[model samples]
Target: MTTSTTDSSTPAPGAAASTDERIAVVNPATGLQIGSAPVFDAAAVAELAARGRAAQPGWEAMGFDGRALVLRRMQQWMSDHADELLEILQAETGRVFEDSVLELAYPLTALGHWARNAEKYLRPQKAAASSPFVLSRRLRSYYRPYGLVGIIAPWNFPITIGFGDSIPALAAGNAVILKPSEITPLSIEVIRRGLEECGMPEGVFQIATGAGATGAAVVDVVDMVMFTGSTATGRKVGAQAAQRLIPASLELGGKDPMIVLADANLERAANLAVFGATVNSGQVCLSTERFYVEEAVYDEFVSRVVAKVSALRQGVPVAPGSVDVGAIITADQLEVIDAQVRDAVAKGARVLVGGQPVRGVTGRFYEPTVLVDVDHTMACMTDETFGPLLPIMKVADADEAVRLANDTRYGLAATIVTRDRARGAELAGRIDAGTVSVNDMLTHCFALGLPMGGVKTSGIGTRHGAAGIRKFCATKAVLVAPSFPNADIHFYPANEKVSPLLLAAVTGLYGTASRVARATPRALATARRLRRELGR
Candidate 1:
């Protein structure tokens, strides 16, 4: 994998606006500019929104069943075009085809789940009975769309993260204006082209192409912004959304942990740890950054992880039949990762395998590295390296493991490898991360029914299954009175002391069996009479 070698020879008909559009689409697998386009100006952004607004009323009026059919069709269409989508994904991110296949599957599964279940989860429902005798007053809650949704997605797993939000937002009856990462716009283009081919309304899923400025414009105009990227940038998006009184679901960053119990199968734990940390060259939000192992098992885990890391292969992204780790997304990201690892080493961390750069690899490929004796103060441990770097620390027991795991500011995900089921549950409870896996790795996020969002700096709001679809809609409470007015309950102008009296009577009735048993019929009759008079 090399730095971007984008295909910028000629514009693809209508890929951009003017002839001088300056958007460069780079292939992270081999630092090449494989494509180029125009940076969308504010006018383009407004145009996208205008289209969404036009499509809104009709699309939303179709009801849940109508939407579900379209979504299911899209799912089948995605499955049919899986090979084509995988090609684009591989070209953009340089991930192995198998990994790309897995990434693509996540959004497809989520879309299918939401389409089939959106009505049940997002449709209006009557709220619980608020007050007895207040039953005549009808009250309900409904989820309403936020008009158009702006999703500014990152490059890593571009399809899933970008379209994942888009599926629900569209299913819940909101139009979507998606600004996919310029680093990997091919997958975004595929989605856009597919939507267009499906006869979906033009503005229902607008595809905007550009860099950070394009993403910022998305945040500027939309009713809601769903951003997935760095913590620092997430804060900026969050603050802007706040100022505009719009909600932003920001998945900032994560320094995820992997806790290995002493009795764990060290071999399985090591294999997964290496895969989790080094996969996709480790540009993952939930990449295992810190590993807290029992003192008895630390050495074994470290040795195995180091050996696995050393054996991984790196090559051009489009290479077939070989597991090739791709390059870091950009040169700037490469610099950031380098600094983190260097600082970590400076701060007492020891590199175990493939620590330095390889001479033959052309792109931003850092060797899959394992570090031991890493402290919390080390940049590799504290900051999001987002590279093929893992730091293993020794802990005396589960207490210290939990303590160290929760020490970070971000709480996205963590894993506990243990043979004992009861002990896994106990340790899972003690861990502060949002998603925890017991005796396994690489799944938690793909569970369509699970609500996956982070606490602390990781994110606000959720996206995946039930929560995702419901999140796209707004809750509106509908209350209606009986068609004919009843005069018996109309004591509007009175002292309203009846409220307290009724409460006291109900409280007395619920006080206890001993008190009720000791009370006379006369006392109970008086309470019953008050309740009847009050329309309870």
Candidate 2:
């Protein structure tokens, strides 16, 4: 996790062209460029993609065990250099040190999960046909690598989200080109260096840094694209991949909700709600944005939320005594947050806690806001407000809670806090989300064994677990017969005897069991006549 200052002339291994134009990677807290990233032109991206394609076969030849060894090396490298990586993450994203540290575990976890399971997941599996005719034939599906992959990552959690998809893609044996968010390319570069140090082949994993054009280039050139960002941008990415007719997996916007039942632990529920809403300053896709509390415990829940939020400390990303919140990413994002808050207040929503930007913070900082009396008409309740704003609305009962939770267009995740495990499980089945957490917020996401993805506008395809690795592969069915010399009864001739017998056999196999009993005798007699006529 070290930074290197490069001039326009000296291009890094897979960096963009040497244009005078550059993107400055700024530290949000200090409002200064920590490092400048190259703006890759179309040509540079093409060359990078070509290099990745050329290097893929050799890497693929490494096999699952070989790739797993490399992944383990990367994990050990990150562990050995955890402190330095944390410093770079904090400097680039302005996230609290604890939050950044928490994200670091995901990469190692993903790498380990894939390394441990890739062979089993991708191995050829028998898809035995149930029909009696094909019972003796061998039919299996083998997972084939997609050759090359392009990843467009968001800036929210640079280390985790930026390179998360790449781990499984590499494990599945495809070369990858990562187009990290221009704002936070530093951590990605740190990852690139670790891969290099682990003795991974050149061009197997590359980074192309720039804005939208760079990402577009990646989508255009690669065989597959995995994008993590806003829904609007994901649509554009999907369209681009559509032009090439290549596959894409998108992890997009989320307006996640939290449902509080009356029987739940009020204190635990409120504490988790505050953490879920404000974690990473609410930049996370799965961060709980809406709260639906049962009327019986609504007031108590709101009170607990205000108390917890009030005690949250905000400052530089990395400081002593555990900073709870960090600076917002940029000025434009801050403006969006402000506008949403203003709109909600104007529409009769009541702000229960801090609602404006923090009074004395030097950099991009917004106070953790809590809103009550919020209705669906308010933008803060419906749209994605990627700031530290928690909106609580009362529900008459569990029915209303579930209804309000599923009312959104996005269904990435939902949380239910309940003491009744059976009741919670039942309600979880009804919630139209990719993941429903019972008495928890984001624990499911970290559980790499379970697949994670979104429904509707949230995302396409899943990440982590076995599905994550398999998504990067194309399943090819392989079928084999005992012998090709022995021709079938339906080979070519339109014989009078075989035709009616074939129909009877079809009817017998597909129709009722009684029909099979009646048809079998005639079909066998026809087969004897046909065999004698064929000179056998």
* Pairs that collide, model 2: none
**Clashes in each model (backbone N, CA, C under 3 Å)?**
16, 0
lDDT per residue as tens, model 2, 12-80: 565545456788777786676677777777888898888888999999999999999999999999999
Error of 2 at 70 (Å): 0.4
| Residue-level lDDT tens digits of model 1 in 1-536 | 23334443222223335234776776665666666655677667776677778888888898778877877877878889987788767767767776787788887887678878888788678765445455567788878999888998888878888888788888888988888777777677677767666656666787777787778877788888889988888998899889998988887799999999999999999988988888778888778888899999888788888777777877666556576566777777777777887888888888877676545655567777778889888888788888888888999998998998999899898899999989998889888877888987668767767877789988888777667777666678788778766453435654465554544555544567666555556556655665565555
TM-score of each: 0.90, 0.94
Q: For every candidate structure, what is the RMSD over all alpha carbons to the true structure, in angstroms?
A: 3.8, 3.8
Question: In terms of TM-score, how similar is model 2 to the real structure?
Answer: 0.94
**Model 1: residues >4 Å from true position, as ranges?**
1-19, 488-490, 495-536
